[model samples]
Each structure stands twice: as structure tokens, then as C-alpha cells.
Target: MKVIMYHYVRRYNPSLPHFRFLDVENFKKQLDYFAENFGFVSQSEWATWVTTGQMPHQPDKIILTFDDAMSCHYDYVYPELLKRNLWGIFYACSQPYLTGKMLDVHRTHVLCGAFEGRTLVAASEEVVSPDMIPNREREEFTSQTYRNQENYSGVSRFKRMLNYFVDPALKTHILDKIFEHLDYQVDSKGFYVSQENLIEMNNNGMIIGSHSVTHTLLSTLSLDQQRYELEESFRFIESITAQRDRTYCHPYGGTRSYNKDTLSILEQLNTDYAFSVNYRDIDDTDFVSSRQTLPRYDCNLFPHGLAS
Candidate 1:
């Protein structure tokens, strides 16, 4: 079985085009490719696979999942999926829905888009301490500490520096300051899916899952904090979906981003399966271990054979 992950799906707008934002045309093409080449798995099918160890009869089955609950998923992706009678698992950050605040990670993306060409130091100087900016020689050292992403290049390197190495409090401060400096208004309408959107999606046969409250790196947090993150987010999802067959996806889902304690917390919360961004082929070893840390492939790595 193959599980694919996506972040954003929207029409291309030059002003704020996020590198990870897959354009609507390409997204449709990818879905077409999937429909032709593989069997689509629904949320219930995924649940049964995890709980009963029953693989789908088709060898080429694929499950679709979206992270961060971007409004574009509701606006664009959802409608397209409905047209095809396909389903996707949407893991949402509860804080955005509950408090109407933009996520820090999203803030980083906004700032990066607004200040695309500026160096990290120049962009962050006003809000971040000069000492926090690593010198040219030490930049590599700093990047290494952050689990340096696979396709880290161009603006993505700067994004990684701000996302991973910088202090969270300071990072939020810097991003907020930058957003203000750019006179940028974060379009809350386009930033996240509202509760109404969640309920509508659930009613329309989509699976809603938790992506934590603050979307913080769970492994960096203490056991109790991790528990709170998981429990509170799970509760919010239950309130909306009214179902306890909970599913979760890790924030910054590196192997190091979650530990055994995180899995224990998910088990306690009655979470059925937890997805991670770890890139690997799912094998017997994955099933032998707990289902909580199932591996996923980023959409970029979809096999060549599966492409047109």
C-alpha cells in the first residue's frame, strides 16, 4: 500500500506562489494519473487496514492525505475530489480553527513569499537577535541541526533556517514583525478551513484528523506537553467529526520529530494511526512495529511508473 502526502493545492498566483503549493492543473493531472494507475482507498478502508491488518485486494492501492488543512483544500482540492468520487484524509491544526490565528509555519511561508529574495539575516534583523544569525561558515552547522530537508535549495534553505534552528518564540516574533513590515494582511479566509468547512467535508465523506493544536514539533516538547497537544487536538476533532476513530499526522514529521512517548500518548487518546513524513517504502518491518508511526511518501517522489 502507498500513502501520498500533500500540503497545498491552488491556482498559480505569482505574488505569493509557495514552492510546495501544487498548482491546480498539475494536481488534477496527478489525480487523473492515480485514478488510471491505482486503486483509491477510502478513509474506512484505511481504518480497516490499520486495525485488522487486512491489505486491500488490489496490489496498487494508494491513499491520499492532506496536511495543515489549508483553505485551498476546501476550495479547490475537495471539489475536485468530489467530482471524481475520491476521498482524502485532512489533518488539521486545531488552533487556527478554534482561535482564528495563523500558524507559525504558515507565517514563515508568507514571510518567505513576501520577502523572497532577501537573506535570512536581513529579513529577520529587526525582530531576531544578531547573535542568532549564524555566520557564513557556521550556517551549515546550523542547517544540520534542523534535519535539513531532502530538496533544500533556493529559498527553501532560508525557510529551513527560520523553521528549524531559530528559537520558536523569536521565530514567531520575527515573522510577525516581517509581516507587519511588508504591510501584509494574512488572508484568514485563504489561510485555513473553518469549522463549517470541516463539518461539510466530513458530511461529504472526507476524513478529518488532527495535526496538533499549535503545529509545533512534537519531539522537541516534553511528554506532558506532547500529551496535551495530542489530547486537545483529538478532542477538537471529535467534537467536529463526532467519531473516535482518531487519526494523526506529525508536524515537521521527521523521524526525530516524534518518539515512543508520542506514540504512547496517541495510544492513550485512542488514535488509530499516526502518519509521519519519513520517506520509505512500507514493508513488513513497518507493520511489525506499531501502526502509529506509519511512513509516507511525499507526492514529489511518486514513482516514475505511476506518472504519465
Candidate 2:
């Protein structure tokens, strides 16, 4: 079986043309392809594989997962899944609801989308403080932080610099500087689904899971900080969802985005499954694969996932 991960799934807003998002129509086409090739796995069947590491002798099985719990998942993806009687795990962050502020991870995405990469790069050059310089080599940092991005070359580089080179304490500060330099502000409203929306989805059989409190890279945080990120986010999910499943999708979903401490924290939290963007099929022979940090392919890697 294969698990596919998705983020924003709404049609590209004419307002944010540079913002990379999967169109609804293309998503529908992907669904058709998956239904024809790999039938969507049932909730119980997937649970069995997750719990007992035993999958029935079925090669035509797939699991759909959505990360970030963007409003687009509720507004666009949910109805489409409902139409096909398909289900997906939607991972959510709690900071927006708790603080009414956008997360830095998402704020950077919006800012990176709003302006040209050259423009953002120039702005970053001006705003990058001496204190913010990374301790390691920049090229190595970019290579690891952003291995294979779908963004245009320039934007991808700028994202890598911002994502890795800056200290976490100064990440938002530098982002703010770039936005100020561009004379633009990232809008915080309605970017994510509401608690009521989560409840409705849960009541209707959709599964909900935690992403993190602020979507920071878990590998960068201390043990207690990691625990807080998972615990706080899961608490919010439990408050809203009727589902009893304990699952989490890593913030960046990359292998290096988490650590041994992260797995330990998940085990402590009694989380049954966690997802990472390892881009591989789930092999029943590899019990360790699904046990923790389960692999997931980005939707863009599959046919009909990207616009022509």
C-alpha cells in the first residue's frame, strides 16, 4: 500500500498566482486514477495494518492523507472525497486557533509566494542580521533542508535560505523584514479550518490528527519542546474530533525533520502512527516502516497531481 500526502488543494487563487497549490479539477482526476488503479483503503483495513502490521493480500490499496488542515481541505477536498465515499487523515495545527496568529512556516510560504524570488532574495539580503547566519555551510544547509522542491529555481533557493539559514528565534523576524521590504502583509484569516468544521468532518467519519503547535521542524527542538508541540496539538485535535485514533504528520514530513526524541515522544503520547515524507510504498515485510515515521509520497509525484 502507498500513502499520499497533500497540503493546499484548492484551485490557485488569481490573487496569489505564485502560490503553489493543487487545483481541484486536477485533484479529481488523480482520484479517478487512484480509484481505477489503487482503490482507497478502508479505515478498518488501514487500522489493521497500522496496529498489527498485517495487510491482507491486497496490492490495490492506498491511503490519502492531508497535512496542515488548510481550509482548502474542508472547502474543496472534503466534498470530493465524500462524493467518492473516500476518507483521509487531516493533520491540524493548534496555534492559529489558540493565538489567532498565522504560523511562521505558513507566513513564509505566503510571503515567498507574493513576491518574486529575486525580490525576496534581495529583501532577505538586506534583512539578514549577522546573528542570523547559520553555523554550517549554506550550500549543505540548502541541500538538506530543501532536497527536491517543486518551486521555480529562484524561489526554491530563497525558501531554502529562509527555511534553514536563519535561527528559529529570528525566523519570524526575518520574514517580517522581507514582508516589510515588499510592502506586503500575510493575511491570517480563514487560512485554516475552524473547530466546528473539524467536528463536522469527524462526525461524518473523517479522521483528524495533529500536525504541531507551530509547525516548526521537530529535529531542531529539545525533548520537552517536542513533547509540548505534540501534546498541545493532539489535545486540540482530541477536543474537536470524535475519532479516537492517535496519529501525527510531521511538520515538514521529511526524515531529517524529526529525530529519535520525536519518536520517543510519540510513543509516550500513545500515538499509534506518525507520517514522514519518505516517498516509498508500505511494505508488509518491513514492520518497522509502518510502526513509526511511516513513509508518504507527496501528491505531486503521482499522475494527475499537478496541472498540465
Candidate 3:
């Protein structure tokens, strides 16, 4: 069984742009292909299959999931999913749902406009100007207190800097301005599905899972911190829906994002399943944990691959 995940799904409207956004036309192709060739399931369905040892008859079993609950997903992807009667796992950070806040790191990434430098150029045909340049200097200015640029590149160092400061409200404000600039129509910072929306998803057969409270790097945090992040997220979700499923997807589920210790902590927290990002599945091991750390294929990678 090979499960795939995605983030954003929207056409590149010149009016509003974002870093993780994927073009809507390509997004349609991915769904059409999967509907024709594979059996689609939700992440929670896979958990039931794994725990109960039920084997799906289909030769190719695929699960669909999205991370961060970006506004684009609500605006574009949700309607598409509903139109097709397809379900998905939307892993959301609880802090925002409860308090309307997000981790500073994400705020920095959005407000800092990291994409404006390289990604914006790649996304658009327009030539970037000095005045239109992204705010790397402001990112550096805010992050220098904790980041050591001599040893790390700006983006890498700023992430580490954000981990040191833990305040959901502060991060929320920074992201507010960023999203506003990205789309002047709405000030949709910390744009996550509301508690009511999560309940609707649950009632509609979609799964609401955890993406941590603050989207912190699990590998960098101590075991206690890691466990806290996972446990709190699980508890918060339960508080919202009164559901028992405690699934977690590492904040940045890339290959090097989380390690063995992180997996061990997930096990310790009694997380039913965990997810990570990759094109292939991790080796399944008993002591290690479930290979449920599923591979998420970024939709932007379509028409070629991740590099494209």
C-alpha cells in the first residue's frame, strides 16, 4: 500500500500567492488519476486497517492527507473533495483553532516572504525588482538574537531561532500581516479550520488529526518537549471532537525532519499513527514503530517530480 499526501490546491491567481500553494489544474489531474487507477482511503481508515489487520482487496491502496489547513485548502481543495465525495485527513495545529494563533516560525516564513526571493520568481513570469524584493533583512533582524548566521543559512537559522521563542499569539500577529499582503482581500492569518469546521469534517467522514500545537521541530526539542507537543495536540483534538484517535504528523515531515527519538516519543505518547513526508515508505519495523509515517507527494511535484 502506498499512501500519498498533499498541502495546497489552488490555481496560481496573480491576485493571491503563497509558498506551499499548488496550481489548481495540476491538482485536478492528480485526483482524476487516483480516482481512475487507485483505491482512495483516509488516514484514519489506514489506522483501522493496520490496527485491525484488515487487508484492502485493491492492489494499490492510497490514502490522501493535507497538512496545515491552509486557507487555499478550504477555498479550493475542500470544494473539489466534496464534489467528488472523497475524504481526506486534515492535520491542524490546535493552538490556532483554540486561540487564533500560530507558531512564530510559520509567521516568520510567511511574513518574511522567503518565497518572494526565489519561489516568487519561479511561480511568476514577472521580473522581480529591488523594491519588490522579499523581506530577508527583516527576517534576519528579528531572528539574529537566537540564530548564528555564520554557521547557518538565513532560512535554516531562522527556524532554529523560532523554536526558542514560544508564544502562539505573537506568532499570530506576524502571520496576519503576511497573509494580508499576500491577499489584500482578507486578513486570513492563522487560517485554520475553525472548531465548527473540524466537527463538520468528522461528521462528514473526514479525519481531523494533529500537526502539533506550535509546529515545532520535534528532533530539536527534548523528549519531554516532544511528548508534550504530541500529547497536547492529541488532547486538544479530543477536546474539540471528543474523538479517541490520536494521530500525529511531524511538523515538517521531510526525511531529516524527525528521527528515531521522535518516533519513540510518538510511541510513548500512545499515538495511534504518525506521518512524515517522502516519495517512498520507510522500512516497517516492530520496535521502531508503524511505517504509517506515510509519504506525502507534493502536488506541485506533478508534471515532473519534487524538483519540478
Candidate 4:
């Protein structure tokens, strides 16, 4: 079986074109390909198959999953999926829904788009402390990560650096300053769905899963911190839907983003499965091992040939 992961899926806003995923028309084309060539599996069926040794009757079965639970999913992706009688698992960060604040990642995306012309150093100077920049470690990390990209710009590299290395509190402070400087307000209507929307989605056959509370890099946190993130996020989801699938998707989901302790915590919490961003197909052997680190293909990797 194959699992496809998506982030944003709405039409491009001119002010924030970077937040756009595949547009509505191309997204429809991708769905058309999946529907024509593969059998769709509901979240329950996929979870059962993961927990048990059983395989679905159809070998061509595939599951769709959306990460970050953007409002775009409710506005654009949900109606289209319903039209085709398909369901998807949405992994949502609980803090935004609970606190009615925008995710820091979304704020970063908006800031990057708004100040695309400015280099990261230049942009940082306007909002962040002078001490934050010119760190030897930060420069080294950014250089190593983007060394292969021939056309990578300073702004892009610095944005990536800020995401992984900067302290979360400092990052938020810097972003808030930039937002105010630009006269931009965080999405006040909420970037993620409300409790009502989650319940409605659950009732309509879609599955809701925890994507952590603050969406912090799990590997950067200690075991107790990881436990709090996992447990609290799961509790929040269960409180809303009154159902527990005990499923999770790693925040950031890179190789170093989660560790063995994270899996241990999931096992203790009775989590059925956990997904990683690693791109590959799932084999039957994966059921016996690697359920917690199961690989999923990012939808952007194959724009034209998802089913091929």
C-alpha cells in the first residue's frame, strides 16, 4: 500500500502564494489518477491493517493523509474528496485549535512570502536581536543543508536555519516583530479547524489524529517533554471527537525530528501507528517491523505520476 501526504491544498492567495499547494484543478487531476488506478482505503481499514497482519483484498489500495490540518482542507479538499466518496486522515496540531492562534510555521511562511526580496540576515536585523545573527553554528548548519542547491538564496537558507536551530521562543518573538513591522495580523479566524469542524469531520467518516501540541521537533525535546506533547495532543483530539484511534504523525517528521524514545512513548500510549516523511512504499514486512517509522510519499515529489 502507498500513503500520500499533503500540506496546503487551496488556490494561491496573491499575498501568500507560497502557502499554496497544488491548485484545485491539478489536485483534481491527481485524484483522478488515484481513483482510476487504485482502491481507496478508509483510515479504520488502514489502522486495522497496520495493527494486525491482515492485508486488504485489493493490492492496489492507497490512503490519503493531510498534515498540519490547515483550514484549506476544510474549504477545498474536503468537498472534493466527498464528491469522489473518499476519506482522508488529517493530522492536526492541537495548540492552534485550543488557543485560537496561528501555527508558527504558517506565520513563517507568510513572513517569507511578504519579505521575499530581503535576505534572512537583513530581515532578522529589523526584528531579531543582533546577538541572534552571526552565530557560527547557525551559519555552518545552513551552509551544510543547502550546499547542494546551486541557486539557493540567503533568505531561503536562513529561513530553513531558523526553523530547525533557533529557539522556539526566540523564533516566535522574531516572527511577531516582523509581522507587526509589516502590519500583518495572524489569521484571526484561525488557521486550523475548530472543535466543531473536527467533530463534523469525524462524523462524516474522516479520521482525526494528533500531530503533537506545539508541533515542536520531537528529537530536540527530552523524553518527558515528548510524553507531554504526545499525551496532551491525543487527549485534545479525543476530547473533541470522543474517539481515540491512537495514531500520530511526527512533527517536522525528518530523520532526526523523532527518536527511539518517541516510539517508546507511542507504544506506551497504545498508539496504533506513527508516520514519517520518508518517501517509499509499504511492504507486508513493514507490518512486522517499522510500523512507527512507516514511510509516506510527499505529494509534491511526483507531480504528474503519483500512481506510476
Top lDDT: which candidate number?
2
Could you tell which candidate, 1 or 2, scores higher by lDDT?
Answer: 2
lDDT tens readout by residue for model 3, 129-185: 234333344454354432212222344433433343323234344344444545523
The regions of model 3 sitting more than 4 angstroms off are 13-20, 42-48, 112-115, 118-190, 242-244, 281-292, 301-308
Tens digits of per-residue lDDT for model 1 on 83-149?
9998889999888877888988887776555555454445555556656654343465455443423
For candidate 3, the TM-score is 0.69
lDDT value, residue 61 of candidate 2: 80
Give the clashing pairs for model 1.
none
lDDT-better candidate, 1 vs 3 = 1
* Per-model TM-score versus the true fold: 0.87, 0.95, 0.69, 0.87
Error of 4 at 37 (Å): 2.6
Residue by residue across 1-308, what tens digits does model 4's lDDT show?
77888876777677764343567777788888777888677656775786685777775577889998888888888889889889988999988877877777777766665555354456666766656554446655555442322322555655665676666657777777777776777554756767788788888888899999988778768889999999999999888875546789998675666888999999899888889877677777877787787788777665543211
The weakest ten consecutive residues by lDDT in model 1 span: 144-153
The positional error of residue 188 in candidate 4, measured at the CA in angstroms, is 3.2
Q: Is candidate 3 or candidate 4 better by lDDT?
A: 4
Show model 2 residue runs off by greater than 4 Å. Answer: none
TM-score of 2: 0.95
Writing each residue's lDDT as its tens digit, candidate 2 over 1-308 gives: 88898888887676676888888889999999998988888988887776788775685488999988889999999998898898989998999989998888888778766777788778888889667875466666666765556677578867777666677778878877778878897678989888899899888889999999988888878999999999999888888777668889888877778899998889888888888888788787656645668888888888988632
Error of 1 at 10 (Å): 0.5
